[model samples]
Target: MKQGTKGFVGADETGAGQGATGRARVPAQPGAEDVGRQRNRTRGGGTDAVPGRTGVDGVRGERTHSEPALPRPLPRRPVQRSSVRGQILAALRTALVTGELRPGAVYSAPVLAERFGVSATPVREAMQQLTLEGAVEVVPNRGFRVVERGDRELAELAEVRALIEIPVVLRLARTVPAERWAELRPLAEATIRASSSGCRATYAESDRAFHRAVLALAGNEQLVRIAEDLHRRAQWPLVGSTPGARDGGARLVADAHEHTALLDALIAGDPDAVRSLMEAHFTGAV
Candidate 1:
């Protein structure tokens, strides 16, 4: 993150008020105060995971879903060997993204273990993973605190996504087989289902799946993995939000349509349209 805004080196205009001589005077240098303010105005501000369930802080000051509570229990995972950690990770991510695990709230692994009905081992393991993702911070003796996220972090995540996916997606669109593109339509549409149902957990998975599926078409595992990591971070839940003209979840619904449009553009092999769509989708609207 940027630490501070750079100081202005010159004047705003070439006039120091209309000169008495009918000629504009050379502008004065920026005042010390102005220079200092500009230099420090910009400052640094403060994770990826999966979803387990729905909307949090839908309408703050009314009823904050996260206040005084842990997130709802983890979603059920399909039985598989060594799946406990994955399930816990998914659940924890969902809780964070949905405001279930309120930002800045510290939660012990043992407590989280109880919430998910699991042993502390997996819970702690899962938290360590999150720490690597910058989603949580370890307290000396307390536990993990869900790192607070806001619009700035969201924008940075989007920027990262834009940087990584734009060129790759454009290339993939031009070269991937039409049949392969056809196979991805359902995955893209999964966002619509999650949006319509207003299920945050489901939406999180579907959203991640859509992006991953699309990027995977490029046949680059490393690229796809990096993109997925950014995608997860971009979806991290905000600590608070400014009341807007639209509801909080409006962007998610709109994104479903955006993904569909993008898929169509990709299938058509219109690199221009694909580029435009990808740029717009990362506007942090959701």
Candidate 2:
């Protein structure tokens, strides 16, 4: 970046993915690399490499054509064949949340493999897994596409969360020992700190952990899984918006308060109050 040049500077930790801090995780995608490549190609005009560090008559010059932007993680690390499928799935999940693969966008395994610099076998396997999860759609001959999320559908899912989770929190408040609440307070605080520091990924994780900790008291693995997935999928909207945007941040803060209230109600054995707070907690927008 030159003293008065107009341009962008972007840097991020390599390979951190969505677990970077503790808010809602932003799924990883290829935006940074792709955009940088496009910009360099466009500005340079010819196929010559844009030297990383250049000198002109002993004066260093790094031209810029945009404003400072968000950090972007480096390319993903290499993976073994055995875990390639899981890697692809993780990649796809990030892309979906980040809106890189828009709803209805067709997916071609071979093409995706090439895009990710991997083998098609793994890509195919990932597509199958995503299809089963209802995150994507498969056509007989057209391959797959990311599914469009409808507001009504999301609301319904949110309702289910309210029903299932609020009561559990209430019960846990009544039965779970006080020590457990003390143990989770740090996690919640850490999540808040992560969000304040603009570590959206970390904030998301901590947020999930806080909610999961509340539900863990129920001791129902199947219900827990369902709740986790629902919460994760609902993050798609936030990923499309700016990290820690005010609306999402406010919602998150409110959720934390709800957690506190639920805990209070649990410890007091106020089941009805707990259920009401829980309903309001999950049904609220992000």
Candidate 3:
């Protein structure tokens, strides 16, 4: 979000030059051309003036030519503390999902803050939020340690998501108009693009966006929030798994394609197709 000034200042052409401070120097007097000539001669040490000594005008070794000053660096806008905390929280979540922050590894807030180029306060705040989400636990005097999740826990999270989302999506497919479902096609397409990039973080966000859009049709704010939270938790990589492991990109692309298929089923007013696709999607997610 930092904006910087571009381009350098150019030298003036009408005998006016920029001073060392980047301000424009005063132009020579109109009728005093003779005086200007004499000053130039004195500067060149062609007259009685010494080259490096102070002149009669108290000026010392003034240059005869002007050099363009280097552009000053622009000041960066200060980031808000809340914004910093939110960003750190998001980054930590992505790291958890991608397995960059290995499970059971203790991470100090000060160390993380230094890596993020921010103060420890925001990182600690973000860590506290992650702790609340059960993503990490405090190690007292050490730091926060990532909580390892096994296959069973991941499967259970997926199962909970299926239980919450499948019925709601199926009900909406029957009552919601085709046009309403059609409007979500862009969000569904976004998942495919994100998956194709092979970035788990991008895919995770787009996947949640698509599901949240679909569930929003249910007209239940609480359900959407709860379902999204469960969806996020289910995205964390299994313990000891590396990023993009287990045919990651291929699996993501396959799951992303299912989104468009589910959208098609909803638009076609086929509740059976919607239910089957939803169940399969949840199953494949784990």
Candidate 4:
């Protein structure tokens, strides 16, 4: 888990915005403000509740001693563990990428548990992980809040992906084995099909897998891992359902055609044409 609290995943952009790019907004927990408001009310009531104030009943009107002695609400304690905590963390990570957890918003274990229909134990574990990742911040008395991302970071990530993958495509254009394309072409088609109608989660995975298949043909596991990391980090903003598009997923069919065209060039060992097409594909819409 990377710690910074200001970063989140990508969403499916073709479903909204200028093109196939969108942002995920983390959703805030419900009724988080109620607790503080309730406590404030008790402090605001009457002067008799104060130490030296005299009441209308005179003669040191009987105070409910227990009221004054009641313990104040304590800060939520951190949780420890890996399994259940990991599950919560996984859910939260998905939520962050899928736009369920909006940025700049905060949550507490109890609130998250209630929303998730689980115990605070897992939620706490998840939040701690998030704290370490810098996706969320833990306030002293208050609970966790989410971090916000800037435009520069987003654009740079896209640029970086283009820088790495475009070159690889150019290199592989004329060199990739015919057997590799035989294997990858169907996967690309499947990805296009999945993206058109499947759930965002499933579609996102397939979409990434298709790209990975192409990159893997280059035989650089290290580069593949780096790209995967970037993809994982962008999940929230790149995979979820957007508010204004029904045909967005359909556009992937066109992307599949682009893949096919690249494969055709590769089969013919046309490196220059491959480079030109691959760069245009990556930099054009994505």
Candidate 1, residue 157: Cα displacement in angstroms equals 0.8
lDDT, model 3: 0.86
Compute the lDDT for candidate 4.
0.66
C-alpha lDDT of all candidate models, in order: 0.75, 0.68, 0.86, 0.66
Worst 10 residues of 2 by lDDT: 49-58
Cα deviation at 96, candidate 4, in Å, is 3.1
For candidate 1, give the lDDT of residue 77: 71
The ten-residue window of minimal lDDT in model 4 covers 238-247
Question: Candidate 4, residues 1-286: lDDT per residue as tens digits?
Answer: 3577655344434333333344545445437476455434434553324554433334454443224654578667766556667878878876775557777666778988998788987787778877776577887667887766654555666678888888787777657677767777787677667666634555556767877888888889999989876765544443234511424655545655676677777777788878777776655433
1 or 3, which is superior by TM-score? 3
TM-score each candidate.
0.68, 0.61, 0.71, 0.56
Candidate numbers, best lDDT first, in rank order:
3, 1, 2, 4
Name the lDDT of candidate 1: 0.75
Looking at model 3, which ten-residue stretch has the lowest summed lDDT? Answer: 61-70
Per-residue lDDT of candidate 2, residues 1-286 (tens digit): 1378666542334333435473445655657767577656645644543444332223345542332443577668776875878888888876765456767679899999999999888998898888888788887777897777777777887877777776666667667777777677776676667555544445566678878877777889998899888877765543134435546566666666666666666656667887777777777744
Model 4, residue 26: distance off in Å is 64
